[model samples]
Target: MSEWFYQESQTESFLEREFVFANFLEAFAFMTKVAILSEKNDHHPDWRNVWNKVYIKLSTHEANNTVTDKDRNLAEEIDRIL
Candidate 1:
């Protein structure tokens, strides 16, 4: 497993990963999966979706910093859904 979704950068407080689906249904399904997992973990992602694509950014709001274990874990979970 990778330690990160991407390399941590000083200019940004979070790490982002983009995913594309074949249709809106697939995108929305992935969003719903992320939402459920976020609720369960009490960690939410900053996300946006349009048509068949979704962009996800993970961060620990309380830490106000780059990627952490929580973010990496969530990113992996999201990847599984994709």
Candidate 2:
């Protein structure tokens, strides 16, 4: 998953990525879109925002914090939003 940076710890494995935007407003707007999408899919990302960048990580908490089809699907949809 070159498009995503994969990470693992004793408790979890996740897919992480940074989405950059032209400005802070753009990044926040994108996050709003993602919030809608996440609500629809019932899969929310672990994310942080700093100015023009959004750092996202996906892991299935119910699946013991591992990446699953839901994570991949959400990641793809987020990419499409870009």
Candidate 3:
């Protein structure tokens, strides 16, 4: 299986991750927490959820879709939440 974070598909301009939980409720709860954190930081991730899984893509739009330190830091924070 792939890791929590990886270079998205054949691209390096974005960092991507997938988190799996037991059920939809757990997944939504995690998304809620991340949403709050994203709002506070003003560095939201491109994310989606389906069933028990959450997929996140992080990149700086201002930097031409490059992965920046903000993305790395946010990834770290998300790891902590897990």
State in Å the error of residue 15, model 3. Answer: 0.8
Off by over 4 Å in 3: 1-4, 8-12
Better of 1 and 3 by TM-score: 3
In angstroms, the error of model 3 at 80 is: 0.7
TM-score (all chains, Cα) for each model: 0.82, 0.94, 0.87
Worst window of 10 by summed lDDT in candidate 3? 1-10
Off by over 4 Å in 1: 1-11
lDDT per prediction? 0.80, 0.94, 0.84
Error of 2 at 48 (Å): 0.6
- Candidate 2 lDDT over residue span 1-82, tens digit each: 4689889999999999998899999999999999999999999999999999999999999999999999999998988887
- Model 2 residue 72 CA deviation in Å: 0.5
Taking the tens digit of each residue's C-alpha lDDT, what string does model 1 give over 1-82? Answer: 3533564667567778778899999999889989999998899988899999898888887786667889878777876765
Task: Report the number of the highest-TM-score candidate.
Answer: 2
- For model 3, residues 1-82, the per-residue Cα lDDT tens digits are 1354556534448888889999999999999999988987789999999999999999888877788888888888888777
Per lDDT, what order, best first? 2, 3, 1
Clashing pairs in 2: none
Minimal lDDT window, size 10, model 2 = 1-10
For candidate 1, the per-residue lDDT at 3 reads 33
| Models ranked on TM-score | 2, 3, 1
